[model samples]
Target chain A: MKAVGINGYGTIGKRVADAVSAQDDMKIVGVTKRTPNFEAKRAVELGYDIYMSAPDRENLFEEADIPVKGTINDLYDKVDVIVDCTPGGVGAKNMADYEKAGVKGIFQGGEKHDQIGRSFNSFSNFKESVGADFTRVVSCNTTGLCRTLNPIKELAGINKVRAVMVRRGADPGQVNKGPINSIVPNPPTVPSHHGPDVQTVMKGLKITTMAILVPTTLMHQHNLMVELDSSVSVDDVLDVLEKTPRVIPVEASSGLGSTAEIMEFAKDLGRPRGDLFEIAVWKESLNIVDNELFYMQAIHQESDVVPENVDAIRAMLEMETDPQKSIAKTNKNMGIIG
Target chain B: MKAVGINGYGTIGKRVADAVSAQDDMKIVGVTKRTPNFEAKRAVELGYDIYMSAPDRENLFEEADIPVKGTINDLYDKVDVIVDCTPGGVGAKNMADYEKAGVKGIFQGGEKHDQIGRSFNSFSNFKESVGADFTRVVSCNTTGLCRTLNPIKELAGINKVRAVMVRRGADPGQVNKGPINSIVPNPPTVPSHHGPDVQTVMKGLKITTMAILVPTTLMHQHNLMVELDSSVSVDDVLDVLEKTPRVIPVEASSGLGSTAEIMEFAKDLGRPRGDLFEIAVWKESLNIVDNELFYMQAIHQESDVVPENVDAIRAMLEMETDPQKSIAKTNKNMGIIG
Candidate 1:
């Protein structure tokens, strides 16, 4: 089994740690925490060997009576591949340590695309990262976009695309973040950063994106419009999306209406953490206007990329040559089924 | 001067009363209220007589010690034109009373297009409503779309259009309204009701719209993309929009970034009720991708249609023969000069 070390045990880090633990092909060696908070204690409760992210600040954990396995460097020495879930810029800073340990590094979407030189989405660009030294997972929104669009592009050949992302103001755990009573145009500009981020994985995709932060912590809703090279019926588009592994086609007729209702559905399914790893494409919202395909999908911001991260680990370590098999393994292990 | 009766003393009703009071060619005869609410008391305090909408329930006002002038019929009888601002379906129910009074009736956007048979946007269909018995002012979002698209349609013919409206969760005064922590797709459907409603006024204008309700009371932001018949540059589009009355172009560099800042700017300008009578289009967001023009504009949901209501009144009564002249007069009286 490949040994995986998760760097940073915060929102994404803890989830990645659990996802990696759930996989049969790999086991989490340890997880690092900067401070000895409740999550650090939970890591210990979950039988994870907690490492000090900042070795110099080890006293913080010691004072809180939390036992540390070792420093981050020690954890790196024991693992074959490390998923760097450290918040944005910090992962780039951890690059040298990864290089020194001679281990493959899989960075989260938060990092800049240039940091690892290769952006990854299993369905779109898995082969590009096979046995590579490092790869970066695109953000949740980009992963959500690519998962749906890449298949359609292959089927119909896209001419151009426009998407407006209604983003959650904050993650459920992020209590302090807000536009609590406002919808702020995130960049307040045309073709937001997400469009180019999708281009990083699925090269030369002609898409422009605009994002607005709404007062919600459940999920980000993407209203996507694509002009295709050929005409398509609503069923033709639905057939393609329904067959895609990680894209779940939900129907309003099923009484699953909004993101709120979808979240409740996830909880009803007994999903761990009530996390929805798949992009919930409202089947009712999917429609075809001539050669254009339009639909709105909800991306659970915290969990959509969790499965992608697992598949990336498989790609970087050459654990699975077939992306479909790797995706099946990750989804099955995470209890994601149609 | 034409005498006007506002047949609902609620959000839109009160704002229309103030706007009409400011106009040179109209006078507020009275306003109707269903109960002895604070707004009814405030209307009397402001020196405008209050009429009981349900005359049989006049005891409700008497018990609350608020005097009622007469029944809604009494107010309708004294007015030459009545602006029906009752909530949604209620306005349609008030239609027969208007017909019996032998007065021209103006309806708010909430009422269905078939209720009046003619929809009015001072810019797009002003002439259509001139000397007509009744005209319905389009909703705030539709009004915002028409104000910008109508000018662009006139300058460089529009081929097709798509818009995503990030709507506010509630009007600020709507204390109990919510989506408090969720971004609910208002309809979760393609080509929402706003698109068809726009066609009611700007006929044959091909457009598809999608909307989501965010947690905000300030304004609704629309991200619009239009395929024009001819190639146009950013400057070409901006020039047309800048020349359009009641569409104000705002720049991010000028420290007006989002709807929150724009609303604050309105208050800073000492606009009555901090109302923004114009659609604030982000000048920086106006860009052209070949034959397509893309931009985002903010619609102050409370008051963007206030000026439209005033101009619709002019069109139905032939108070101003020219649409531009009526628009200019309405904007000037409401202090909406650039």
Candidate 2:
């Protein structure tokens, strides 16, 4: 079994731990938390091997209810791979530590693209991350765009892509955080930071993005209009989307439920919480008159990055010859049938 | 027989004239145009009783290949009902002339809500305009919103309705209109003029709207987020929309087509474009957690409003008493049978 260590135990981290535990070939050997929170206490009760008391401390495992001694250096020897689910810049700070420890590491979405050796999107750039010791799973917005845009680019070849993303303020579970009413434009500028990140994942694709932050703690909705190099019919577009793996086309009758609804649908469809790409298309919105302009909406964010992180780990480990097959095998091992 | 006169033989006007002529109770008595346009010549060649020249003082018959004699004043006396298909604001300007001629008139979507005594929406507000002598059909945006909102309001009682309408720059056949690549916020402001027009038609319902102008001339898409008074499930919302009289639920297997595809689907389903409400729902967008917020996109303007305008005229004439029965009769008369 491949021993895995999780360096943070927050919402995404806990879910990642659960997902990793569900994998047949992976075992959760250790989990570290900065403070003794409810989830951390629970992780301790479950009997992990090497539990560090703090993320930054070199030697501190004594804070646990049951006293144990271990240094950060000790954790490096315990697990073959470590997943750093720390906030944005923090992952880069610890990258040198992970490299010196000689363990493969997974970075979260908050980390900037340049911070890691490779940016990962399982469906699009899984092969690029092969044999890289450190990889960054892209932010949710980029992940959602890549999943939808990849198929369209493969079939239609986009000339110029324009997008307007309506993002939520917070998670439904986050308290004192959100439930915003106004639709505030993100960056208040035409090309947002999020847009360039999407470009990073889809190199050579000329794309522009705008975003509006709405008051909701669910999934973000991206209104994407693509000017393709060639013209295609709506039927042709739908055929391409249907054939693209990891994209879940929400039928008009199905009624796009909510972020929770999408997540639940993903679970029902056997996709991990963030592995879903729920596209709710308005047929009329697909203006194929000249067949060059194609319009659609893509939903994405944090939860989706988890699956990419898993695929990145498998690719970096070179567990299988074909990266896609390895990713597929990992998905099956994690019980993600979709 | 009611003598139907068509003033302004444009695309919609010509279709209206053709549709009315097909009815046994309606006859094409007179058709008018500003100049001896091709359609005017065609109308004269079709052998109607009189061909009245539009705004121009000269008689069109004298100028035509087939010698005839009539002015605008002559047409006023010859036809019982004059359908004003002139450009915006022009309909209201000519309304008094038609009324003075003792002719009941039908106005297209160009006239503002305040310009007419009564506004008509075939599915939602047709009964309100019944027996009214001069009725203006609500704009395509209002018609689209009413079709989707009215049913939900009737079934679920909305608390607040927030909408973002992405409108097409020009109707099909309009000239020098669109760059087709740019998306500008319509009116470049929130609570656009179109919003109040929609509110005026939806009197007694509380709603707010935003508008964006896109390059496509096909159809307008209204992204609506509605807060219902009570909690509801996605299934419940879908059930209500599917069972609603005029709303046609686009099936999943149909794939995402254009407004034209959806309109064709409505036609195939035997629903007249005017009374037909083609709804592509995002059930997950319906945040029923508190069972309050519901998000959906409604297709409007362009072809969707054409059938509604027809039904509005039928309703104004009091041709049928029961609204549902009238819609059915109108659909049958239009030969929109599946």
Candidate 3:
């Protein structure tokens, strides 16, 4: 089994660590935490070796009733690949340390594409990460877009895509982040970087994206308008999306509507932390009018990238050569349904 | 002053009556109810003269301690106009009674547009209803589109418009309706009739709409994609939307993002029934990409058309000549913020 070490145990990091543990060909070496907090203790409880971020902070874990296996340096030495889930820009700082250890490095959404040679999304660019030293998993928004876009590209050539990314300000546990009472044009500029970031995986894609940050910590909703090179029916678009592994067509008949109900359903389904790892598209909203297809879908902020990280591990380590095999294994092991 | 009576005192009827009561140019003659339910008693408490739909059921109201001032015919005899707020297709049946009484009839969205010569949304076809004998108000979803599209059509020139109406399965008080389990492809067909309903007012406007009913009761979220005649900047689109009378630019800095938060804000603003009479557009999500303008907005399914109903009363009676003056008066009286 390929050993995987997680360099952070925050929101994405902890999720990544869990997903890594779920993989068939991968095993978790350890998880690094800066603070000896609840998550650190919980990691220990879950039987994960807690690697303190700093070697000197080992006593902090001891006092906090948390046990540690070693420092992050020890984690790097023990692993074939290390996934960096530190905050934005911090991943870039950690890149050199990863390179020094000679283990492949994987970064989360917060880091810029230039910090890594390639951006990895299982839907489109999983193969591109093969033999690469570093890969950045696209943001939750980008992953959702790519998952839906890949099918459209294969079924029908897309002329252009204009999407509005209605973002949630923070994950549920992120109390520090908020514009809580208001919505803002984040970046306060036209065409937020999401479209270009999507271009990192999809070369030559004509897409312009706008983002609005909302107060909810549940999920981000995307409003997409895609123009096909040729006329297509709404059914044609639905067929493509339905075929995509990560696209779950949400229907009112399922007694679920709104992100709130979706979360409730996840809990009912016994999802870890009630996370939905698939792209939830409003099935009835799909339409082709005057040669244009319109639809809306919700992206669960924290968990969507988790499955992609699993697939990325296989790609970085060359464990599973087939994309579908890796994705299916990752999804099945994580109990992810689309 | 135009004398107006509401037929059927449920969701749309009661709201229409309250809006008429708020209008300086109109007065409520009475409102009819078939059942002596809580809404009927509440209408009495709100100082509306309650009339029984079936005069024979007058005893039901009397037994329920709800006093009635008159019968449906008595309301018809006194009012110059009657607004039909009954269930779908019931408005068509009531059309003849309105004609027999020599009173103009206003139908809500539930009615088929062909029941009346024109479908009215104050923003789009308010003027067309002037001097017309019968007018049908567009659906709440259509009202939202018209509110946003009118500004775009005049300011940027819309080449085509495509939208997905993510609907609420029922109103907040509507405990009866739901597909609740799944998001079914409603109409199960392409280009649902909402676009045609909008066309009835906009006149040859090239637009198409698909609808998905979700299990939420608060409001309906509309995803809109408009192809502009020319390339406009994001600021340019903002400028036009700002000028629109009933379009509220939703900013995250104000701490509101989801429809639920918008409702909370509305209640905090002291709006009756926590009703927002304007279209709430996520301002930051507005973008002009590749000359295509995209955005997302929400319509409080019950109250969005309330102000429009007030304006439609004026239109049918020729009370206020300019549509803006009527909409402005109604909005100010109802405390609607654009």
- For model 1, fnat equals 0.71
Docking class of 3: incorrect
Tens-place lDDT per residue, model 1, B1-338, is 99999988899999999999999889898999997888988999887888988869878988988888899888877898989999888888888878888888999889999977889998888999989988899999999999999989988899999999999989998889877766677787887999999999889989999888877889999999999997778898888888888889998778887788899999998998999989999998887877888899999999989988898888888888798899888888889955
Q: Per-residue lDDT tens digits of candidate 1, residues A2-58? A: 999999898888888899999999999999999899999999999999999886877
lDDT of 2 by residue, A37-137 (tens): 56766776766644553545433344446433364566778787888887678888889999888998988778888878578887777778788888888
Return the top candidate by TM-score: 1
lDDT pick, better of 1 and 3: 1
Pitting candidate 1 against candidate 2, the one with the higher lDDT is 1
**What interface RMSD do all candidates show, one decimal each?**
1.3, 17.3, 6.7
Q: Which ten residues in a row have the lowest lDDT in candidate 3 chain B?
A: B179-188
Q: In candidate 3, residue B273 scores what lDDT?
A: 82
**Rank by DockQ (best first):** 1, 3, 2
Estimate, for each residue in B111-193, the C-alpha lDDT of model 2 and write its tens digit.
87678777877666778878888888777677777877887887778876656665666765677885233333344323456
> How far off is residue A327 in model 1, in Å?
0.4
lDDT at B154 for candidate 2?
Answer: 78
**What are the per-model C-alpha RMSD values against the true structure?**
1.3, 20.3, 4.6
Candidate 1 C-alpha error for residue A228, in Å: 2.2
Per candidate, the number of residue pairs that clash is 0, 18, 25
RMSD of 3: 4.6
For model 3, what is the C-alpha lDDT against the true structure? 0.81
TM-score of chain A of 3: 0.97
Model 3 lDDT per residue over A136-249, tens place: 999899999999988887887888887767677777788898744333445444478999999999999988776656556788777777888887777888877887898888
